[model samples]
Target: MDRKGFSRRQFLQMMASSTAAAIAASAMPLTTLAQDSMSYNEAPMLADLVASGNLPPVQERIPANPRVVTPPEEIGQYGGTLRRAFKGISDRWGPTKLNEEMAIEWDIPDPDTVNVVANYISEWVQNDDATEFTFTLREGLKWSDGHPFTTVDVQFWYDWYYMGDLADRPTPITIAGEPMELEVVDELSWTVRFPAPNPLLPLAIAKLTLGSWAGPTMAAPAHYLSQYIPDLTTDQSLIDAAMEENGVDTWQQLFGDGGTPQGQIAGWWFNPDLPVINAWKSVNHPSNDPWLAERNPYYHAVDPEGNQLPYIDGMTHAWFDDNAVFDLWIAQGEIDAHIRHVASANFTFYKENEAAGDYTVLLWRAAETQAFYPNISHKDPVLREIFNDARFREALSISINRQELNDLVYEGLFEPRQASPVSGSPNYDPEFETRWTEYDPDRANALLDEMGLELVDGVRMRPDGEPLSFTILFQSALAQRGDEVNLVESYWEALGLQVNQELVERTLYQERTDNGDVDVGVWSADRNSVVMADVSRYTAEQADGPWAPLYGAWWANSPRAQEEPPADHPIREIWRLWEATLVEPDEATRNALFKEMLDIHKEHPYMIGTVGEGPVPFIKKNNVGNILGGNIWDDTLRSPGGVASVTWFFRS
Candidate 1:
C-alpha cells in the first residue's frame, strides 16, 4: 500500500502556512485581536443570571477571541436538556468522551485527514526540530467557576501534582525516558522543552486517553486545589481537620478524597464542585438517578453569530444497570442523543421503532468489534511457551470463522478482517487485514498436531501429559464481548481444546490482566485509525491494552513490573523503532519507521483481530439540532466530542 496522508510533520508545517489561515478564518481566533466591535449573544438562562448580577455579561464571560463553531445544520435554539444514558459509575469514559476539553484537539476536516488545532489554548508554536512547544492560553479564558485559567494552572499541574506526590500517573510527553521541562513564558503562555525531538507531542496531546482534562497531565485549578495541599496552604490545622474528616492518616490521602482535586477532577461526574473548562459543568453527582450538567456560562467557544455555546441549556444522564433496559429506553424516545452502549444487536428493533419513537438512528463506523489477545507472558510457563510460538498464534487466528461470527453476532453488518488499521488510514495494508483470518479447522488441527499435541478421547493433551486448557477473561460491561467469546469458545472446543470463559467486572478484569494471570484477554480494537498516537496494542509500551501487560509495565519503567522481556526480545526492537519514530522530523522517514514496527506485528500475530469497520448506532431525538451523522466511532477521535457536541441544541 502506498502512503497517502500527511504525516505529523507535514500537518504541523501545513498548520504553519495554509491551515493556519483556514483556522484563523474559521475556529482559531487570535487572542491578541480584539472582539469589541462584535456584539455577543447569550442563552436566556445565562442572560437572566447576568441581569440578576450573578454572572458576567456574555462579552465579559467569553474570551477576547472566542473559538467559532459553525453549526452542521443551522443555528440551534437553547432551552432543552440533552438526555442520555450511562451504565454505572465505572463507565467514566462514557461522559468523558462527550465532554472532555483539552489544550489541543484533533480536527478531522475529512475522513482521510486529521489535523491538530488549539482548543483550550489560543495558539501554539513548535520549534524547528520539534524539541520545544510554546502554548499561549486564550486571553480572558476562565474555568467553570469563573476563575481565570492561566499558566499558573499549568505550572501547578506539572510541578505540584505530576512531578510531586502524584508521580504514579504517567507523564504525557517523554523523550529518552526523561520528562519534559516546563518554562513559564508569561501569565498567558508557557513552553515545554524536551531533551530530544518529540514530533508526536501534538498528537499525544490530542489523544483522548492521554491528554484530555481527565487524563494524566490534567490542568489543575490552582486556586481551588491549593486549599487541600498542606505545602500550599498556610493553615496546618485545616489540613489536619480535612485528613481527620476524610478518615485518612496522611495529607496525600486526604487531598485525593472524593471532594478534593485529584479524585473529583479525574472523576468529574461524581463531584459537581470540580472546576472544568468543558462546555458543561456537572451540577449533580452521578449517584443521582439522572445526573445533570448545566452549561458553563464562561465557556470559551461561540457560534459563528457570536452566540455563546453550548446551544443546549443543560445535559441529563440517566443511569441503567442493564443494556436491555437502556436499549428499551432508546426505543421509547427517552434519550435525546447518545453514541456509546447502543447495541448493534438491537439495530432492527431500534429501526422498527424509530418513526414511532420520533427519533433517528444513525450508524457510525467502529474500528473493530473485538480483538483477542493470547497471553504470551502468562504466568504458567508451559502455556506461555505454547502461546509464544508463532504457529500456535496463527492456528488460533485461522480457526475462528470471522464471517460466521459477523453474521450471527452483528447481523452480517460488520466487515470480517484481521486486526489492522482502518481501511483508509495511511498505514493500512490489505494483506495485513486479511492474513490468517480464514475458518480452516483442518489446518488448525494440523498445526496443533505439528506442535506434538495429541488428541485423546476428543480432548487435546499438552506436552506435559495434561489436558490443554485455557480461560478467556473478559469484562461483563459490554454484552457483545460475551457473545463474541462464547462463539470463539465453541470453535476452539470443536478443535478438541478445553476452553472456559469467565466474565468479570471491569475493575477485577484490569487487576487480573495487570497481574499477568489471564490466559486470554478480550477487548475491542479501538485507536485503530490513528495507530501512531497509541501503539500500546502493537508494542508493549503501556498496560492500557491486554497484550503483554507485564512487558508493558517494564517498558513504562513502572515499579509494578513483575517480569521483563529478555535483551533479544522482538518487542525491544519495536520499542527502539517507536522511539526513533518519535524523534525523526521528516514525515516520510517517520512513516517508514512506523511501517517497520507494524511489519513486526504482521509477522507475529500478537493480537488476533476479528471483524472491524462495523456500524455503531447513534440515537438522536428529532428535536436535537446540530448533530452530525456518519462520523468514525473510535476512542482516538472521542466520538461525539470529535463531532463537537457543544453546538448541539433542541429546536424550539
Candidate 2:
C-alpha cells in the first residue's frame, strides 16, 4: 500500500492499546466483570474501524493560483519565406530536428527566438499566480490529408501517440525518468495539473508555447495512424512485419537510438511523395541541390494582418560538408541561407569576405560552450579520492587560464565564465560569481598541498598513499584545437599532475558519456526551460537507469555531496513543496516557493558553466532577415532568443 494507507494502520493500533488500558483501570462488580471481559474482546475490533477510514488527513498548504491565459496581442503576424541549410542529421524529418523546424514554422504561438518555442495554448497570470489557461486550436488547422483539425486531433495525439494504451502496440513508455501522463478534460480544453503549485508555470508555459520543451509533435491524423494501431494489436506479427519492411529492429531505433547513422527512414518526409503537416511543406528534393517548401494552404494560424500565414511562398535548403565551401556559398549568393555557422575559428574568412563586400556575417556568442567536469562514477577508488578533494577541483579550475585560452585559442571571440549549468539567464547569481583562478603555479601548488597531494618521483600522490593521475577522454575530431590541448597538457604538467588526453571518435565519445565510462571530460549543456520542470527532472536520482545532466559535484543531495543528505532531505522537501504548490491557492506563497527552488539550484553548482553563446545563422544577402540569433541557452526550444520564422520575408 501507499504511505497514507500504512500510516492509518499504525494509528489504529495505538488507539486500540489506549482503550484497553482504560477499560482495565475501571474497576467493576463481579457480574459487571463478565460484561467487561466480553467488551475487552470486542475492543480490539473497534480499533480496526479506526484503521479503515477514521484517520486524520495529511495536511498541506495548497497554491492559490489558477490556470493562466495569454493575451491575443502577444501573437505576431507578417509574411516572409526563410531559406535554411540542412545539417548532417540522420533523418531530416525525424521527431528531433524536423519537429523543431516544423514547430518554428507554425505550431507554436508567440516565440522568443533566442531561447524557446511557444505552443498554440495561451495562459494568463496575475503576478505569480495563474488565474486561467485557455487553449484555442489553430482555427483552420487541418491534417496533410485535408481532414479538419478539432479537439479530436488533440485527444488522438495524447491517447495514441503519447499514452498508447488504446492499442496493444508496444511503445516507448518511459523517457528521462517518468512515464508521460495524459488526461483529457474535454474537447478543445485540457489542463496539466502540475504535481504541485509552480510559480514559474507562466514562464514555463510561455517557453512551451515557443516549442522549447515540446516540438510541433504534429497532431497525428488519427485517421491514418488509427488504421495501423488496431492492426498491430489484432495481429501479433504485424509489428514484426512492419519492422522488417523498414529494415529496423525496433521503432525507437528509427530515430537514431542515441547514435548517428548515414540514413534512416523515420518520418513522412522520408517519402518524397508523402504529405507533411509543416508550415512550409516539402515540394522537391535533390541530393546535390537545395530542397524546397511551399506554404500549406490549410495552415492553422491567421496572421495579424488577417491573412493566412507563411508569408513566404517557399524555401530552399542547401547542404554543405565543408565550412569554407559554405562561406563561399554565402559570399557568392549561391545558397539562400546558411542556417548554421561552422567556421567561427576562421573569423578571418568572415571578416575579410564581409569587408570585401560579399555579405554580412552575424557573429553570435553561443551561450552553452566548453567546460571540464570530473566523472565521479569512475571505478577507481584512487582517482575518486583525488577528485573528492574540493581543493583539487579549485586548483584545476585555476590551472586553466580561461581568459588566455579564449584569446590565444579562440582569437578573442569567446567569454570566460565559472562553470555552471544556468549561467546565461537571470537565474545566474552575480554573488555566486567567484574570481577566475589566477594562472599562478604557486597557488595551484598551495591548493594541492592543502588537499594532501604531494609530488613523488615526478608524480602527484595523495597523502593517503594514493596516486594522483587521471585520463581525460576527449573528442578526436577536435583537430582544430590540437594546440589548445597541448597547452592544457603543459599547464597541468607543471604541477606534476599527469593528465592524459585520449582522443576518440565522436560516436565513441558520445557513447562513453552516455554509458558513464569517462573519467574527466569537457561537454556543453544547452539552455533549457524549467517552467515544466522537465529540464530539471532527470537531474536527481531516478528510480531506474542513467544519471541526469545535473549529476555532478554541485547537486547537494547527490551521493558525492560533502554532507550526505538524510533520508527525507532537500530533494524530498522540494517534492513536498512542489506538491503543495499544486494545491496552494495563494500567489505569494507559490512565488516564494519557486524562488526557494531557484535559490537551491543556485547554491548547487550542478554543471560547471562556461560561456553564453548564440546559435548564429548565416543568411544569404537576399534572405537578410532570415537569420535567427541569440545567446545559446542550455534549452534550445525555450531560449531560441529570436523571432519565430513567422516574421521572415524574402527581399526582392
Candidate 3:
C-alpha cells in the first residue's frame, strides 16, 4: 500500500489500474504529460497592478528562495475564474481562499502517506538524539501585505499563543507530558528543544494531512498582531484602547474569522489588510454571498521555468442550501470540480451524468469505506459498564452482518472491516482490521447470555431486568446513513438486543456528544493519517465522543478532570503506548508501540467495525488542466489541494 518507491506518475497509474472497485465503478485515467517549460514571470493582473503603482514588482514580491514547482504538463497561462461552492455557514466557514499547505512537500497521489520534504524551511539541523531541532528559514519572505516574515514571528506565537491561553490547542509533540522549550538564534533561525527525543517534530511543522499541530501557515506575523497583544506593548493603555476601539469580546475573535485582520479581508479570496503568505488571498466574507478570492501579488512560489505559481487569477465559491440544490448544479455543469458531498451512493449518479456535464469521473481510493461508526460511551453507568467489557465489545462487533450493510450502503464496493489503517498505510496491520469483524449471531447471543442477559420475546433483558435498548445519535450529513443505522438496528434486534437510532442536527449532535448526552453515536472513525497525526482517536483521545467519553474528558481537561482515571483503567495501556510512541526515537520501537496500540484496540475495540477502504469520486471539468493527478485525497486533511494544487492550471 505504501508506494513510496514508485515515481509520482507511476503511483497514480497504479492506483487507477489496481482497484476492482473502480473498474466496475467507472472512472477515467489521468493524463500528466509534461508541458514545455518556461522561466518565472508574474501574472498579467499583478503586472498591471504594478504599472498602476498598486503593487510591488515581481522580484520584490518573491521569497529569498522561492519554492520551485516543475510544470506537470505544458506551461499554463494565468487567467481564469475557478468556480467553487459551499453548503452552509459554520465554524471557520467559507471556501478555501489559499490552498491548505505550509512550507513543505505533499503526497497528493497517495493521501495516507506523511509524504513530504520541505517548503518554508531551507535547512534543518537536528541533534544526534533529536532533542534539539533547529531550522534555517528562507530570507526576504514577505506576507501578502508585504510584511517581512522572520523568526521573531515564531517566538511571538510561542510567547502569546502557545505558552499563554489564546488557544488551548494540545502539543502532541510533548514527551511524558513535558512541554518542549523554545529558543531563537537569529531572525532567520529558531530551535525547539524537547525534554526527550521527538522524531515527529519535523513531521509536525510540515504535516498538513492531520495530527500533531498541522496547518499551512506555521508562524503568525507579529508585525500585524502585536498591536493587540497586552504584553507586547509597554503601554497598557494602548491594549485597552485597541480593545475598546475594536468593540470585540476577545483578541482571537477580534483577530477575526482567522488570524487575518477584517479590514485587510479581501473579497472571497481574503481581506486586503490581512497579510498572508499564500499564493491567493481571501478579499471578502463568504457568508450571505458568493465568496471570491484573488491572487496574492507577493506569492513566494514559482514554476521551474520561473513563472509565478497559481496560474489562475481568481476563484469564486457559490453556496447552495443542501445536497439537492448542489446536485442540480453539478448535473448542469455549473460546478467545475467538486467532491464534498459525493459519496459511494452518488458514484453512479456522477458517472451517468459526467458526459452531459463535460467532466470526467475519477474513482480514487478512500481511506474510509464505512463512514458510519457506533460509539459505546454512555452517560448511564450500568450501560457504560456493559459496553466497557472487551468480550461484550467483541461479541457486539461480530453480531452485525457487515457484508449486507456494505452492499446496501456502499454497493458492496468496500471491504467489510472496522476502523483501523487500510492496506496502503505504513501503520496498517491486517490483524487489527479483521479481528472481531465476522457476523455471528450465535456467538453474539451466547456472549450476551454469558453477561446474564436473559432473552424475553427476542429481546435481551439487562442485569437490571430492563430490555436491552439504546440509541445511536446521528447527524444528517452522512448520505443514506439512516438506512445504514436501520440495518445495524436490525442486526442487533436479531441478536436479542434493542438498538434505536436518533437523528440530530450537526450543532446539536456536537453539543450533546460534548456534554456526554448520547448513549451510542454513529460517526466516521479516523483515517490512518489521523491516527499518526493525532493519536487521540483510537486511544479515546478526544473528550466528547461516546468512545470512553470519561477517559477522553479526563485526559483532555488535565487538572480540571471531573474524575481521575483509576490506576487500573483498562484503556490506559493504549495511552501509555501512545506516550512511548511519542518519545521513542527508534523506528522499530515506535512501530512496536503503535502495533501494541492496534492490538489492544482489537482486544478491546472502542467502536464497532463495519465497512472501509472504498473508492472516492473526483470530477474534473474538461476546461481544467494540469491536475497532475486526479487524486481523491482525504477532504478532511485538505489532500491533493494542499499537496499538488500549485501545479494545476486552466488549459489555454
Top candidate when judged by TM-score against the true structure: 1
484-581, model 1: which lDDT tens digit per residue? 88898998898899999888777677778877878988888777666776666677544535678788777776555458887987888988898888
- lDDT to native, each model: 0.74, 0.43, 0.62
Q: What is the lDDT of residue 579 in candidate 1?
A: 82
Best by lDDT, which number?
1
Candidate 1 worst ten-residue window by lDDT:
18-27
RMSD of 3: 6.5
What TM-score do all the candidates reach, one by one? 0.91, 0.65, 0.85
Q: In angstroms, how far off is 584's CA in candidate 1? A: 1.2
Residue by residue across 390-462, what tens digits does model 2's lDDT show? Answer: 5666677667776777777666555566543233333334444343335667888888987777789878885
Clashes of each: 0, 73, 42
Kindly report which residue stretches of model 3 are placed more than 4 angstroms away from their true locations once superposed: 1-39, 91-98, 109-114, 167-169, 208-218, 233-248, 252-272, 369-377, 529-531, 542-546, 558-563, 628-632, 635-637
Q: 1-652 in candidate 3: lDDT tens per residue?
A: 2212224354334434322222122111212112223334788988898899998877777765776655555677788877777754441222552355454434333332334445655656778777887866666777778888788777776665556544433455456667667788999888878888877665444443211122333366678667766666666675566557657556554544222223221112233455666666766665546777788777767776678888888777776656677677777888776555656666677778888988876555555535333344565767877877666777778877888887887676667987776555555567778878888888888888888888998888878888888887876555346777788888778888787878765667766776667777776664344345555567665543457665676665532223445688766777778778877878788878888877887665777768866666666787887653334344333444544565567776
TM-score of 3: 0.85
Supply candidate 1's per-residue lDDT for 475.
76
True-vs-predicted CA distance for residue 154, candidate 3, Å: 0.7
